[model samples]
Target: MLKLKYYLSLIVWNLFVNTLGKSMFTPQSIRFLLYKMAGMRTASANIRSGCSFRGKNLVIEQGVFLNHNVFIDSWEKVLIQENTAIAFDVLICTSSHKIGGPFKRVGDSDRKPIVIGQGCWIGARATILPGVTIGDGCIIAAGSVVNKDCKAHTLYAGVPAKEIRPLENREVNANIK
Candidate 1:
């Protein structure tokens, strides 16, 4: 019975995603619609229109919102943890070219998982390169290019995303209050 269920699920998923290319609407619109309708979550989360997600290995947790025009390429597993917000036009990629030879074939490429830890905010236009992890509560500034792992509770900016400063709780509260 379980095997039958699994096979049925696989067939449904393939038909819905592959044969259809999920083409009932635009990719972003479809993602928003599906996430709102049937995507499970511990708390309500809003995914704005115009966010594009490809590949099937993606996971979005509770209270994780994907803002407008954000592009998430999930060829490998891309996990966005609870309370994380990916801002408008933020691009998260999980695939990279093979560097071994001059001409790189698609089959020779490398793919790795991208993990966005809980409570992290990836700002608008931030480009997170393949295989990078943004730790919990970290802030990725707008227009930055991140190709390295970011520490928890810190602010990272600039090309390649060097840590700028540790996040201060009192400072955050002051702004909120």
Candidate 2:
């Protein structure tokens, strides 16, 4: 069955590709090949070892580099556009539990997609919450917790991630290699 195959592939990826410490030394093409074989849509991506995700709702565009220990909990969908670089230990989640009395009692949770536009740079250890849309050429500061949508060509930082300043005349340099 389809579901059985999906689970088996997930197990293989986690065991063979994600857990091995030496998998980082493996060529990027092999890593991408394994991910694509597991049903993820990836193009020219360099996802380092120890990166973990569930399901097949991840779309990583061309020239995107995901550094080590990146965790994408894509219960919904996650779209990382071209030339984006997500740094180490970044957590991009697409699901969270609902708060309040009745919802908590019923174990209700919400799911929404996360979209990171082209030429964006997500700094180290940034936590992107559910339903966040980071615009093109934006720079997320290190250790920032982004709970809301971000604007293009700007820098965001801090706990809740406030816009620090607009990146004037620097959108051309925001493309990550």
Candidate 3:
């Protein structure tokens, strides 16, 4: 079947990437080409070494930067728009488990897409859960856990990633160190 073939090819490609592709000698353009060849939607974004992915449902737009050790489990589609910068050790997953009855805490698997709008900055160690659509010009602070949608032009930082405040361009420069 087509699905079987698709999965098999993806597996092989993942294996190849996880090994030799992570080497510094491997060019990022070659990685992008390999992903595209395997039917994944990707652009000329700079994906650093040690980054891992799952499935073919991924879209990395132009000017996006993914730092080292970023993990993307794309059970469903994950679209990172242009000019977005994802810091190191960020985990973006498209698969989760539903809460079930008392006997069985974790129920069936739930897969949903994640859309990161243009010009967003995801800070280091942030964990973006399934079905999260981050709006444009947003900043996710370090070590935050994003479990819901984020609004545009805002700063979010917390355990559950509450919106700290709306971002406004200020004209004052001060150094208080």
Deviation from native of the Cα of residue 113 in model 1, angstroms: 0.5
Go through the candidates in order and give each one's C-alpha lDDT. 0.76, 0.85, 0.87
Clash totals for all candidate models: 0, 0, 0
Off by more than 4 A, model 3: 1-7, 169-177
Candidate 1 on 86-142: residue-level lDDT in tens?
899999999887755455444466899999999998999999998898999999999
Error of 1 at 163 (Å): 0.7
The TM-score obtained by model 2 is 0.84
- Regions of model 1 farther than 4 Å from truth: 1-45, 103-107, 169-177
* Candidate with best lDDT: 3
Tens digit of per-residue lDDT, candidate 3, span 38-87: 56677744888888877768888999999988999998999999989999
Clashing pairs in 2: none
lDDT of 3: 0.87
TM-score of 1: 0.73
Error of 2 at 41 (Å): 0.5
| TM-scores, one per candidate | 0.73, 0.84, 0.86
